[model samples]
Target: MADHRAQDKLAFLLSLVPYLVDHDRVSVAEVAAHFGVPQSQIRDAVRLIGVSGIPGETAQYQHGDLFDINWDDFELNDQIVLTNRVAIDDSPRFSAREAAALIAGLQYLSALPEHADRAAVASLMAKLSRGASAVPSSLTVEATATDGTLALIRESVSTGVQIEFCYRSAQGEAQSRRVDPLRIESFDADWYLRGWDHLRQGVRTFRLDRISEPVITTEPITFRAQDVTLPETLFEGSPEDLLVTIDVVPSAAPLLADYIPAGAVTTEIGGLFRTTIRVSHYHGLKRLLASMSGMATVVEPAEARTAVAEWAAAGAARYR
Candidate 1:
C-alpha cells in the first residue's frame, strides 16, 4: 500500500510540472485546488520542480541545468512562476505496432454497415502507415469464418451466382443444398447467410460457421439483392413463433437472436440470462435444449421444461 502511494505521488509530481509549464504563471492555491491537493503539497511540488532538470554534458549541474523559479513572488504572494523551463516533447508519434492496431480497427470500421466513408478510412490508414517509425507487420481483421468460407459467400453474392454447400441443420443433420445468395449479415461476432434455398423453396438463414464444402455454381442467381425484400430482422416470422422463456448462459445469448423478438427485454437472474425466444413448437425447444446440454435451462411457462423432460423420457424408453 505504501509503495502504491509512492507511485501515485511520483505520477502526480510528473504531471504537475507539465500543468505548471502550460499555465506559465499560476497561484500556489490555484494549483493545489486544481490538483485537489493541499496548499502545502503545491508548495512542495514548486520546490521539487525548482531542483528538477536534465543534467548537462559535464557530470555536474550547471546554472541552466536546474529549473529556476522567482523566489520573491513565491515567498510573498504564493505566486508560482518558472524562470527556466526544460524542452517539452510536442511531436509524439505512435509506435509501429500501435499504428498497425489502429489501422486494423479502421479497416474493420470501414466494413461495418453503418460506416459509409471507405475512402476516409483508407486515407487514415495511409497516414498511419507513413507516420509509423518502422514498417508494421502485415495485419488485418479477418471475417468470423477464416477458412475461405466467407470469401466464397461474398463471391457468390457479388457475382449474382448460386452457392452449393452441405449445411448442418439444427437437428445435426447435413444436407446438400443450393442457395441463391441474397445477403450476408453479421449479428455480434457470428455471421449469417440469408438466401433463397432451392430445397426448402423459401428464404432460409444459415450460420456461416455451420456451412461446409461451399462451391459457387456457374448458374446465375434467380433473385438479385435489390429485387428481394429482406426482413428488418434476419429471420422471417410466422404465426407459429411460440414464445418460450428460458434461462440461457450469457455467452450463448447472441446465438438465440433469431428467436428473440426485437422488443423483448432480457433480464439476469441467478447468474443466468433470462430471455424469452420464439420456437415453432415445444418439441423443437426440447431439441434445442438437448443440443445446448447444460449451457441453458428452461425458466418459465412450465410446459417448456415438461416438454424437455418428456422428450428425454421417450428417448430413454426406446433404449430400454
Candidate 2:
C-alpha cells in the first residue's frame, strides 16, 4: 500500500491530468516542474493512471475500461499523450468534514494580524462554507497574539537578514546576541526561532516570547552549511542520554504525558503511573521534576533523585 502522504500526492496528480490533456501532449519534465515534484514521480503517476480504469462487464479491468496512452512517445520522447481516458475534468468536491477542517484552519490563520489578508481570508471562508454540505458550528480555532518582536523576527527571516535581540535564558539570565534567522517554528503552542547564533558560534533555538527589542540587521547571513541542521533532540544530555523513570500521582499523570516522548513505556500500579522519560542531563530532568511540584518522584537512578532534591533545596534557600 502506498503511504498516506504519497496517496495524497497521487490524488493531486490525478486532478492535474484534465488540465494536462487540454494542453495537448505536454512534456513530463514540464509537468513535474509545475508541480514542484521530481520527473520520475510524474512518470510514475502517468504510468499508474495508464493501468487504471473502471471495471468492465466481466468485473475485471479490460478493453474499454483500461486507459490507453501513447507509450512509444512517452517512453522514447518523454512526452505524455493520453490516447483514451474517461472524462475526469471536474475538480473533486470537499466533504463536509474536510471543508470544516479547512475553514477552522483558515480561521486561525486569518486571525494572525501579521500574516493574513483579512478581506481575502473572509472571502475564502465564505466560499468554503457555501460548498460544504454542513458547515461546522462547534469548531473554533483561536489564534495566538502577534507583537512587534514576532514581526521583527518574521521580517528578518523573510529578507534573509541577520537580527540582534535581547534573550532571557531559561535560567533567567539576560544577554544580547546576533543571529542569522533560518526559520521560525512553533512546537506545542510555543514559537521558537531556530537560527545560527553568532555569539555562541552554533545553531540554537530561542523561544520567540523571550526575545525583546529585535533589530533586523543589514548584514547578510554568514553561517556555514555544516551549522544549519537543528538537532533531532533539542537539549542534548551531557556525555550520553539517560532513560529516567518517575512515579506520578494519577492526577498528575496527564501532565507527565506531555513531557514524555511518544512510545516510552508507561505503566499504572496501584493508582500511580510509572512513566519513563529520556533526557540529556540532570538539569533538564530536575527542571521537569520541579515543575510537577510534589506530585512526581524519581523511581530510578538515585543520582537523578538526589539532584532533584538538591535543586529543590537551592530554590527553597532563595526564599529563606
TM-score of each: 0.46, 0.46
lDDT, candidate 1, 1-320, per-residue tens: 99998898889988998887655568988998898999999898788888877777895788778888998999999999877665453267688999989999998766542243467778788767755667776888875553377667667766667889998866578999999877668765567778888898888888887899999999888876667787778767678677888999999887787788769989999899999888867866886777777788887788887888888889989997
Q: Give the TM-score of candidate 1.
A: 0.46
Identify the runs in model 2 with alpha carbons over 4 angstroms from their true place: 1-92, 103-148, 223-227, 238-287, 290-296, 299-320
Q: Which residue runs of candidate 1 sit more than 4 Å off their true CA positions?
A: 1-98, 105-127, 131-137, 140-146, 198-202, 247-275, 280-297, 301-303, 306-320
Looking at model 1, the pairs that clash are none
| lDDT, candidate 2, 74-162, per-residue tens | 99999987776553522565778888899888876553323334678777776676445555555686534535666676566556578
Q: At residue 64, give the lDDT of candidate 1.
A: 77
For candidate 1, the 10 contiguous residues with the lowest summed lDDT are 109-118
Using lDDT as the measure, the top candidate is 1
What is the clash count for each candidate, in the order shown? 0, 1
